[model samples]
Target: MVVDDDPEIVNLVHIYLTNDGYNVIPVYNGNEALSVISHHRVDLVILDIMMPDIDGMEVCRKIRKDNVVPIIMLSAKTEDMDKIQGLMTGADDYMIKPFNPMELLARMKSLLRRFHLFTQQDGDNSSHKDDVVQINDLKINKDYHEVTYRDSLIDLTAKEFDILYLLANHPGKVYSAEDIFNLVWNEPNPSNNTVMAHISNLREKMERAAGYKMIKTVWGVGYKIDQ
Candidate 1:
């Protein structure tokens, strides 16, 4: 997602990314970015700071509540505080105005690599054990990065699959959002709604497919799967 009010900026990025053999989604504004993300799969976001509706900071914050997608904030506000705020708001990286396209591409590549590694690390850690974990009618195949319910395929993002496998692998064990985030993201982001949001999304999918929720939320404690 390349979000900016300027068409030229978006076009430049789209061209560079496309030339690198990457799929580019050119979003003209923050709202469009959010809408597109909700509907499509977005690996990363290059967001501009200033816009008429829903600036980059607010977009970053909103996205943080639900997603761990890599975000790079582009801003003309060359202030230390601005950069700090962007990072605190869930942006993975920040860039000043008139940024070098090559540098941006390098940073994007770095973040993408890190994000993928972090999301898939749990499966690697349990390599010595069976990667496939089946709980009742739900089956998670970490080796293939796939999930199935009642033998039907259930599509999921990489993070969603990680969180699901983490819980289903240990039936009856409760894990707080902080624990899940740290274990899955490999980053200590406690007290944020990111984990909750992911759980909610995952739960909905399970219910819709299986006609019942497989994940149990323990109020005040965390989430678990009944044995």
Candidate 2:
């Protein structure tokens, strides 16, 4: 899916992606993109930051609340802060305006390939069980994608679950932000703030459920599921 207010850019992306054998869905606004995304299974989203009605960041946040679909942000703003803001809002990748079509295609292919690998890993490990991970009173069910604290269920988004699963699967292992980003977002590389925001969000949700913190930050590195 491609969400951009500029018809020319949208058309250009659509033509390029369709030629690359992808079924492209192009929408002119973020709201329309949201509506379409809710009803469809999109492999990835190319979202423009500035738009009428709802902006891309809000749309990205909304999508991240439940969906783990890869998002590549498009923006005219070249500032490092703007890029950081986009990634913090849940974009898997970012591209400044006037990007090469070939580069865009390359990024799309890389993201999709990683996504494929993640799904394959899930299927392969479907039956391998540590079933439950218990750190104090917090419990994470690997197979069911459920988290519980003292027997109370905790609602988590797909990204949150992925983060928890990664950490819990290897207790005491410190994962750098880049590693976490690749594992959760299925990108070859991802912005540090993207990993940080998701981890912070996950911790907040977990803390609310458990009444205490379970995930620990590893200073100068990333995070770890302290055993």
Candidate 3:
């Protein structure tokens, strides 16, 4: 799925993706994109940050609530914070405007390829069950796909869930942001902001649920779910 306010860019992207053998779905605004996504299954989303109604970040947040579908944000704003904000809001990648259509295609291919390979690796054992993982007051039930801290359920997006799962599964192991991205997002090379944003959101949720911070930031490194 592609969401952008500019028809020219949309058309160009569509043409390029079509040539790459992808079935492209294009929407002119964030609302329309959300509507389409609610009704259809999409492997990846290429979203423009600037749009009428809701904007890309909100859309990304909504999508992340239940779906782990990868998202690549396209934006005219090249500010470091803008990129960081996009990634924090659940975008899997960020691309500035005037980017090459070929690069977009390559990114899409790379993300999709990684997604497929990871799913394949998980195989039939990936089904969620009711096993509860407890670390102090933080509780995560893999079967129910639920996380709770101090007895309150934490509302986490799919991306957040995957990140937490990876960290909590290996509590003491400090995973680099790149490692988290490659393993959870299936991206060969993911943006630093993408990892940062998701980790920030995850920390927020964990803090809200546990009433204290459980994910400890390793200076100049990544994060770890403190045991």
Model 2 per-residue lDDT tens digits across residues 32-60: 99899999999899999999899999999
lDDT for model 1, on a 0 to 1 scale? 0.80
lDDT of 3 by residue, 1-227 (tens): 98999999999999999987889998999889888989999989999988888889899888877776878999999898999898788776789998999888887777676555434433344453324567887777765566777778776655677789789988989999899988886757566677888889889867776667888989888889878
Per-residue accuracy of model 1 over 46-165 as CA lDDT, tens digit each: 999999999998998788666768888899998777776676565666789999999899978876875575356453555724777888788887666668888898866455677888
Q: Any residue pairs clashing in model 3, and if so which? A: 88-197, 129-143, 130-143
- After best superposition, candidate 3 residue 161: deviation in angstroms? 4.4
Report residue 2 deviation for candidate 3 (angstroms): 0.7
Off by over 4 Å in 3: 114-162, 177-193
Question: How many pairs of residues in model 1 come into backbone collision?
Answer: 0
Please give the distance, in angstroms, between residue 135's alpha carbon in candidate 1 and its true position after superposition. Answer: 25
